[model samples]
Target: MDNSNGMAKELAGFLIKHYTEQLHSIILSPDPRLHYPLLVDFAELLDDNPTLAHLLFSHPAEYLLVFDEAAIWAQKVIFKDLKQWDNASVKDYVHVRINVSGSPLECPETFPSIGRVRVKHRGILLTLKGTVIRSGAIKMIEGEKIYECRNCKHRFKVYPEVETRNVIPKPTICPSQSSKFCESTRFNLIEDNKICHDYQEIKIQENAQVLGVGAIPRSIPVILKDDLVDTVKAGDDVIVTGVLTAKWSPDVKDVRCDLDPVLVANYVRRMNEVKSGIDIPDDVIMKFKQFWLDFKNAPLKGRNAILRGICPQVFGLFTVKLAVALTLIGGVQHVDASGTKVRGESHLLLVGDPGTGKSQFLKFAAKLSNRSVITTGLGSTSAGLTVTAVKDGGEWMLEAGALVLADGGLCCIDEFDSMRGHDRATIHEAMEQQTISVAKAGLVTTLSTRTSVFGATNPKGQYDPDESLSVNTTLSGPLLSRFDIVLVLLDKKNPEWDAVVSSHILAEGEKENDNCNEDLKSTWPFPMLRRYIHFVKRNFRPVLSKEAENVISRYFQLQRRSATQNAARTTVRMLESLIRLAQAHARLMFRNEVTRLDAITAILCIESSMTTSAIVDSVGNALHSNFAENPDEEYAKQEMLILQKLCIIDEFPDLKSNLQ
Candidate 1:
């Protein structure tokens, strides 16, 4: 006991010598009664006293108490007058939050993943990263309650045990004396003497992108105390530093008494950034620049190289791959003068036959984004796609659905045609407005759904050249318009194409990739490709050049003159889609200026998406298109004819902006 006291005194001296400034500020705060934990960097401690730091990680419960005592004593020593801030003398000080820097001692290689946390990690400090799937209602829990015995009128304090959380156990006999002498089991608890603190339970699930194929995502319960409670909610990505502890499961008849692991959070930080909290290094950014510099002259060909990495096994769907890249690396989001928000994310829809590889693209797109949610639309409801109110522990809590959870990322829906009409209608607001408004169970709030939708659906029966998309898919015009690029992938009978697909499939690994022979040399692997995507999204935000704007205006006028069957083609939404695609294309080429070539490419994308006869005659099937030898020359000739037509419309300035 004397040795332990000396050790604690040594730790106290260390604290006073190291964190004197931090302790002084916290102690001299306006309200000393409030708990303001002094953040102690563990790395600094490791440098100062390696032995003490190692002991702190091993026996956290005992050492944390000592650290708390040291912090209080250090504050009093530094300030000299601790009672000036508080009316009475302080008995207990706030906790010392140890910031675990660098890699933890979980695996000795890297920080432990959520699924890697096991029995060996219990009672020790570790860090975890996960998404908050659900959170319980905040409630006051008793930390310490005072009890008075009836026999001798003796006072004692009872703390809630881990197994029986929030429920203090009653004493069978008087704690003041032995049961044989007292012969009393009665005890009275004083409500006024109870010490309560805010508490909540949050369920965190591992990242889906990190999980293996067909493996079920694992989740763990986290306990938040005091100031940590209610700091985060569903759909948030959080990093928690805590101690792993175990609690007994519910006691039921014929049920085994098992212990479940739960984390008691020491510190919780929320990362609400759009990048999914990925930290990219400066050297990697230099690599990206060097990757582009290799193909300085032919930028379009260079972009195709990156697109080749998208679903590499699938053959000859250059257009689909290009659209996927543009959708993932979307345009800049800005607010207009009227305070209306313009979304930058691009939505894509693939309407194809059974063998057209639509589902392949959907899966690949989901895997491409760091933060994504993939779900089938079969039997899906508005509550499932948006937000739903769930009752947990007799309290109402708002649970995030597919779109809500995929905020600032992608939400891919397979079998989109299988969803009900009412269910499909619920996502119209989420797709365009980028938010889900919930007013249920006496909770009224809005959750962000700033995600791009990648949906794949089949057309009813056979392809109809004369019918509109709404009649073919049974989707409303408003809903259909939400998608910026609606590519129709009809598996038309062509013997040459069939022979090519047959030879490719049979050859397997020996299949020839004719579309990207030279460009595929610079194709990146999956990890590097994903990092490149995140890099562009985090760094680049492109703005339109005047030439790009003019090209977009010309295409909008041409579409309005064509009198499209699709309602999406006729609205101002189409114009917004054009600008977004152009900006995205510019970013894909690693340029800040949305070039004229970018505008021309976006126009060609829109032209191919439509089913008009004029487009089919001029632009070939998108699935069969390849990287042109000289795209600039081809685009120049095409824009010349469009410019000739624009000259006629130039006569009437009033007719502009009235594309409807």
Candidate 2:
């Protein structure tokens, strides 16, 4: 084996030992039929560790990480293994005869027919391991062994003989169907001249082993010699397995999952020698592996994918989605897309304590691609995430803020709660509507800011024990509802948890300082993230369905009817949000169909946010209004002042006369 292979083997062995030692202690479960001790090596293989070659060779495809699909396969394998091990003993006789499907079979050359097997154990027959039951196989006949009782001279099948001395062999005292057997002789002859012995069933299990080299894992796509563009069809499952390249679009201005066919083909061809399974070159694998590790270790790829797909020009300033610590604190490792891909809507929020890395993720995302923009909720002009007025070559130029810049990518907003309340009012228009129209500077310029926003904020006072419900916090209901996901972060004291956090932090720290400021020079890992983000945006686009359209329309109509003001604007904004969210969900699912479910889900998310905002605002507004304008309270205060004057008058009557 080459150096890479040697390394893979060593890594795989280490992982196997590590997993086996920790399996019982951990909650890790294994299937009786399939080996789970092999998973550690499987993960190592994906890591492309050369030491995992032995495990890979035996069950290469089985352990290949296919994400969601792999989990399902593992579950099934575990169930099958457990079943086989539950009933392992009872193979005492080399050629034991058993009745199956109305036919007698010994050593079971073929499986008992499906119908027969179902009938044997009340429609749930248990078969031994390696039992092959053909469709036409028959059940065995009963009463093969029988004997005549010597005492009664009556023929009967002896299943469990009682006393051997009192009973005769062969023609007397049948041993085939009796519950008792004779005790006189060790072996008793039944009517059919067959000898019978008492035997009990025992369960047996064997360690799962590979009979031969397993199939190549689906996750590891082999580089085919053929050009995918020339040979692959639209629906064909072609794995290009090529290195990513930089490709930008002015229209999207963000890093989306798009690939330049030319770039892809070029990269694929340059990876190694074509048309050979000899082995992936160490140099080539190492370069890609490093890239993969870097991408995985950082949030660059995930954020870039979102940014590139949404906006590209102002991708700078927005942070990437690399807040692993924040995610853990929120009790979420991975969140399901909010029904957008299938039905069409989703909302996500990022809430955290100070220094929880939320700001970093947003800023990284903004700067990673040309498509994203960054904004904050500090004291600023109201409406539109970022709108500025300036002279434009002899005319007033209406400049758009981070939201507009992130038209197609992502809008990374920091200090979201710190934004002015009036300015917050303006976002209600752009967030849902996808466009920011400025009716100022004597110019009616509407900038298209159809972006996915990843907003970060800290809670007021302290983190609450119950965060799911809305309370008096800096984050308003209107804004919170816009997000399909609500993630929160808090500090931890657990060592194990801290180790995981440290691993991520160390990985990120060691990376090149891509984003450096005077005091804090930290790398955001945007360049690498941009590549992955662009890849996803390019390849993932789901179409909206008519059914989805109907659902959204009805939802909008309802929202409009319920809204106190700007009903049409709110409806339209929510509509756009639903569409974008649906598209994102579809991309995540790797599907092209934007079903009705996706639209409904999108509607639900939008409505939830809108309703919550309306409630909170109404309550606050009612309180302010009632307290601000109360005629009765004012009269009461005047009356109290008059009474105090009268009481003072009596005591100071003479003093008042002198003053007069």
TM-score for each predicted model, relative to the true structure: 0.86, 0.33
In the range 1-660, model 2's lDDT, one tens digit per residue, is 144344444443443344434322221332332212122322344344443333333332222322213233333333343455544221111110111222221123223222222222221112222110000111122313554555434454443211221132244323333355443222333444554322111111110121123532111111111112123211111112111122222224354644211111111111111211223345743643454456553322423333332222221212212121111111101223763312122334566677655665665545543344455767345634656665522345444455654444556667777888777777766665555677766765565555566677777767654443245246565765555545455444547655644554554455454432221222223343344334434454577777566655655565566665323226344555666655554443334676654553344334333323322222111101111133334433432333233233233344345435
lDDT of the structure predicted as candidate 2: 0.38
Model 1 misplacement above 4 A: 1-9, 17-21, 81-93, 108-122, 146-157, 170-194, 246-260, 271-279, 291-294, 505-508, 511-522, 613-616, 648-660
Cand. 2 TM to true fold? 0.33
TM-score of 1: 0.86
- Computed on alpha carbons, the lDDT of every model, listed in order, comes to 0.78, 0.38
lDDT of 1 by residue, 189-255 (tens): 8788656778898988888777888877788889998778888988898888888888887676797
Estimate candidate 1's RMSD in Å. Answer: 5.1
**Candidate 2 lDDT for residue 388:** 62
Judging by lDDT against the true structure, name the best candidate.
1
Positional deviation of residue 556's Cα in model 1 after best superposition, in angstroms: 2.0
